[model samples]
Target: MKTTSYISRQVENLKPSGIRRFFDLAAQMDDVISLGVGEPDFVTPWNFIEQSFHALEQGYTSYTENAGMIELREEISNYLSGSFQLDYDPNEQLVVTVGASQAIDLALRTVVEPGDEVIVVEPSFVAYVPIVSLAGGTPVTIQTKAEDDFKLKPEQVKEAITPKTKAIMLCNPNNPTGTFLNKEELQQLAKVIEKNDLLVLSDEIYAELTYDDNYTSFPSIEKMKERTILISGFSKAFAMTGWRLGYAAGPADIIAAMVKIHQYTMMCAPTMAQHAALEAMKNGRQSVQEMTESYKQRRNFIVSSLNEIGLSCPNPGGAFYAFPSIKETGLSSAEFAEQLLQEEQVAVVPGEVFGSGGEGYVRCSYATSIKQLDEAMERMKRFVEKRL
Candidate 1:
């Protein structure tokens, strides 16, 4: 039998992750300065790591409850309430998953019926489109622009709505763009959602990474609590990317439905990781703040440097990426990325891979050390000068 014949049509239809492709190419080249990775370069905080070690030393290697350890859920609950004034009952409104990625997938798989239409704001996370497709839902993409700081506008959401629209997936402090949706902006979106009776999947994994202001949680919007599923995790903020832990909070019914899928598929999040997360939730605030400060400094430098090099980047309000326009370079986003990699040995993801509005730009992650960023910026500057 042909290999293609054996593959599920859903799986076959999906394109390989564009970000992963760049990483693979970068791995083969010597001395490549990569700005393509998304995770923090920092190690997991020492206290969190110590807690993980203590858990292992005590032989706490058993499975957690299907919904996760109650203590951990309580910590999550407290973190949400304390940090964002968002309240969720730890008992019935939360489900721990392998990571925020799994939380997003489970939420999509649980609520999306075949042919359901999901409004995806772009340039959004790479996973949203494929996840919606895998859930047998059709994705309707609404492209946000650089002029508006890439925020999803109420008018755009209103225009995208159809009778089939089931949910809206939002990535605040959005991946690639690093743009956040403020309170007033979310309120405008809330009105449209209320009128249409739609659900919301909010991916706020970068909630703690925002600079200049605190993050506004989707569920914090008046009357949006029951309709929103807030997805967050340890990966981005705590620098625990490899630990693979996350959770979802929302109405009990929807969370229970997601937990049903989780019970059968994942059983539960890793027990030791949950223990570490417990520690993180309890005392990791200072570590998170220090890291966010470092990222803010890097963000300022990168945005300044990119602009100086003739790439017009709108300063991102949150998260650690710089999305700089490459339009003036007279190259398509892909051509700019490819040639930059080949000539300058610097790897950055082409914004075109992010979705429609992402064309004419590139997403460079500032998650690495400043020294590496400095080297990459210098290399990029030389590359831009040559093209000029």
Candidate 2:
């Protein structure tokens, strides 16, 4: 049989991750200061790690309930309610997922049918469109503009809707750009969503990293809880990326559908990770605050530095990324990223990898230490100057 014939067209046609090629190239280089990665650089708090060790020592190594351990789920419920005013029943409205990435996949897979359309905001995380396609839905994209500070407007949401539209995917404090929506902004969009009778796959993985008090949980909007699948996790805020633990909470029926699919594929999130996340919910506030402060400082510095270097970046209100325009250099996003890497020993992700509306820019993660960021900025300035 021909290889093409044996493979599913969807799997075969799926493009390789645009971010991976940059990472692969960086890995082969020496002494490269990388701003390409999106994860928090902070080590997982020792207390949380110790708690996981305790769980393992106590022989809690077996698989958890497919939805995850009750204790962890309860903690998640309490935490979300306390922090974001999102009330969920641990038993029926929550599922401990392998990661927020898995939660996004589960949410899409649960609701997206062959002809359904998901309206995806552009310059989003790389996974959203592909996951929508894999879930058998079409992704209708709306490109947010820099002139509007990259905020998706209520009008755009209203315009994107059609009879077949099933949902809208939102990454508040969006990746690559780090643009966050305030409560009022989300409410305006919420009105449109409510009118359209559409579901919401709101990815708030970076929710805890917002620099202001304005970050609003989408499901917490009036009348939105029933139609929203709130996806989040411990990876970004708690520095628990390796734990691979996340969860989704929404209407009980939607959550049940996700859990059913999760049960077959993952069985359960890692037990030790579930235990660690329990501690994270209970006592990880200090670590999160400290890291958020550190990130704030780095965010301030990087945005200022990029502007001074003439990259013209908006001061992102949340997350650790700085998406700065490289258009002045008169090179494509890919060209600027590749040439910068070859010229200066720095690695940053080209913005084009993110989605439409990301060209002429590059995403530099400030998740690293200030010392490294200072050096990377200097290197980038030198490279950009030569190009100009």
Would you list the clashing residue pairs of candidate 2? Answer: none
Candidate 2 lDDT by residue in tens digits, 1-388: 5677888899888998889898888889899999998899999999999999999999999998999999989999999999999889999999999999999999999999999999999998999999999999999999998889889999988889999999999999999899999999999999999999999999999999999666789999999999999999999999999999999999999999999999999999999999999999989999999999999999999999999999999899998899999999999999888888988979999988988699988999999999999999999989988877
Q: Estimate each model's TM-score.
A: 0.98, 0.98
* Candidates' C-alpha lDDT: 0.93, 0.93
| Model 2 / residue 106 / CA error / Å | 0.9
Model 2 clash number: 0
| Candidate 1: clashing residue pairs, number | 0
lDDT of 1 by residue, 232-298 (tens): 9999999999999999999999999999999999999999999999999999999999999999999
Clashes of each: 0, 0
Report each candidate's C-alpha RMSD, comma-separated, in the order given.
0.9, 1.0
Candidate 2's TM-score reads 0.98
